[model samples]
Target: MSRFFSSRYANAEPYKPGEQPKGQTVVLKLNTNENPFPPSPRAIAAAAEAAGRVNIYNDHMCRDLKAAASEYFGLPAENIMFGNGSDENLDFAIRAFADDGFPLIFPDITYSFYETLAGLHSLPQVVVPLAEDFSLRLEDYRGLKGMVLIANPNAPTGLARSRAEMEAFIAEDPERLVLVDEAYVDFGNESCVPLVSKYDNLIVTMTFSKSRSMAGARLGISFACKELIDDMEIIRNSGNPYNVNSMTSAMGAAILQDDEYTRKNCAEICRVRGWFSGELRALGFNVLDSRTNFVLARTDKIGGKELYEALKARGILIRHFNQERIKDYNRISIGTEEQMKLLLENIKEVLK
Candidate 1:
């Protein structure tokens, strides 16, 4: 608390990201939902080649990258927007739509970043709670008075609602803006990108960080009607004309060109998620059905915090939220088969 600190930021509570331990120790990290595999070889080559052009500013509009995404997703470049990451895109949405009067609406136990963004912007927030099984109830969101942000295949829980359900929700309020954060959509979840052209009020944000294994590169894309995308572009250019660097832009374009690479990785992750979930259940843990590359589980024998600490002590790292309803649960990212086997062995030892 600095004596000269501004009162505007007095109540700001920043989101705490997962731990990133940097050392020589080999840690089986399942805390952050990062891809265990490396990025595509072509993407790596493109990035390496683009490194030489670092002295020049990246294309402000990210034209080539947008064109590549357009080709891949079958959406026009006019309907696409790019940012530093999906977090930035989400922040842009909050700034563009949410206000003190309009407020921001989201799931009560969804991505924590939504709350942080709302707080940063001083926007009123309406957090609608999910059903008992953590599924979104369409009726609960029938008449939201503000911008709605839904994380498809939501973080921590990793549960997803179907596209039909989402379409119905979007149809409920055509005037209200609905932002779908699909950061984990590649992992066995249906994407709302196809609906962007159909609904003028819908904006879907995705990231290359999760499935593309480019968390370090920090590339994010948003899909919507041209008018909405133009508004987001205004916000983006007003802040930073070159939000994405050349290397990232080039690499992201290359990666999008080779969709098979990410799809293969996503399939593998989903397979591992299923296997890991079953293994956790066999160990007396209650695992939630997940569509993302992570699984949310809780054990009747041990508390989440206790298990989290125990796993960390044994050179493994998993996510544990200290929130009220989910404090007992741990969110574990799906790693390779060998890594998962090691995790299961460690869990058996801990339980014993």
Candidate 2:
């Protein structure tokens, strides 16, 4: 511990991201859930063009990006906000809406960042348990007074609640703030962005990292009512008005304009997910039906850590969590069909 370290963060545990092996080791990286496809050509060109103008300060408000996002999502520019990534938007929401006295509520098995965010802000938090089948029990969250955060088509498990179910929950209490993260929605799940207009307390955030294949661009969009957007903007401007850089803003807007490319890539990922899930099930793995570009599965033939190590040794990287409830499970991000086939072959050998 450094003497200069802040006392406020002394008890905080930082979030551990998926490993990115350095130095071109030629590993098939499937642990981080990145899009297997490349970014849209139009987005790439836009980024290249924007790169030439780095000497000038970027438009801190990201007006161009907001306009494109507004037209694509059918929301007004005033209702749209940009962040470095969806992580920043979620962090802004936690700061803007949550109070120290009122806890932030989320599923125990969902995105681990919620706990990290709560801890970083020194706010109280409550984790509602998922049901035995790993489905989110909406009934359990009913009547809770704290701010709510949910990852749609939730990570790890990838189980999702319908937009209608989400609406019902948001409408149940107009006073409580409800933040829905749709980072994985473009794959197959229905988005709650449209409901932002109907519910003043609702916020929906999306990232270009997953569906748009702009993980390096670090772009995220948020939709909410005008008032909420205004409040969040205060926190955003105070923290980092230029949160999104010039290249990323341009790249994100170009990606929105090239909707055809995004749609095609998402469809391909979905198709691969279906085929790969079936293959895993055939191999006696209990694979959860995933709506995201990844699957969580486990098998009796090998332990989760053992399987992860075996695959890593074979140059195929997947994710394994040490959490008690899901220690036996491994999450494999959907890659190309050929990648999945190679992974399957390695798994069969390991099992044998």
Whole-model Cα lDDT per candidate? 0.89, 0.91
Please state every model's RMSD to the true fold in angstroms.
1.2, 1.0
Where is model 1 more than 4 Å wrong at Cα?
Answer: 22-26
lDDT of 2: 0.91
lDDT of 1 by residue, 1-352 (tens): 8799887766578989999887736469998898999999999999999999888788888999988998999998899989899998997777877788888998888899999988877778898998888887768987678899899988878889899999988987887889999999998888999999899989999999999999999999999999988888888878988989999999999999888998898899888888888989988899999989889999889999999999998879999999988999999989998999999999999999
User: Against the true structure, whose lDDT is highest?
Assistant: 2
Worst 10 residues of 1 by lDDT: 18-27
The TM-scores of all predictions, comma-separated, are 0.97, 0.98
Q: Please write out the lDDT profile of model 2 over residues 1-352, one tens digit for every residue.
A: 8899898886577889998886646468899999998999999999999999999999999999988988899888999999998999998888998987678999989898889988888888888999998998888988888889989999889999999999999998997788999999998999999999899989999999999998877988889999999999999999889999999999999999999999999999999999999999999999998999999999998999999998888778899999989999999999999888888898999999
Q: Which ten residues in a row have the lowest lDDT in candidate 2?
A: 19-28
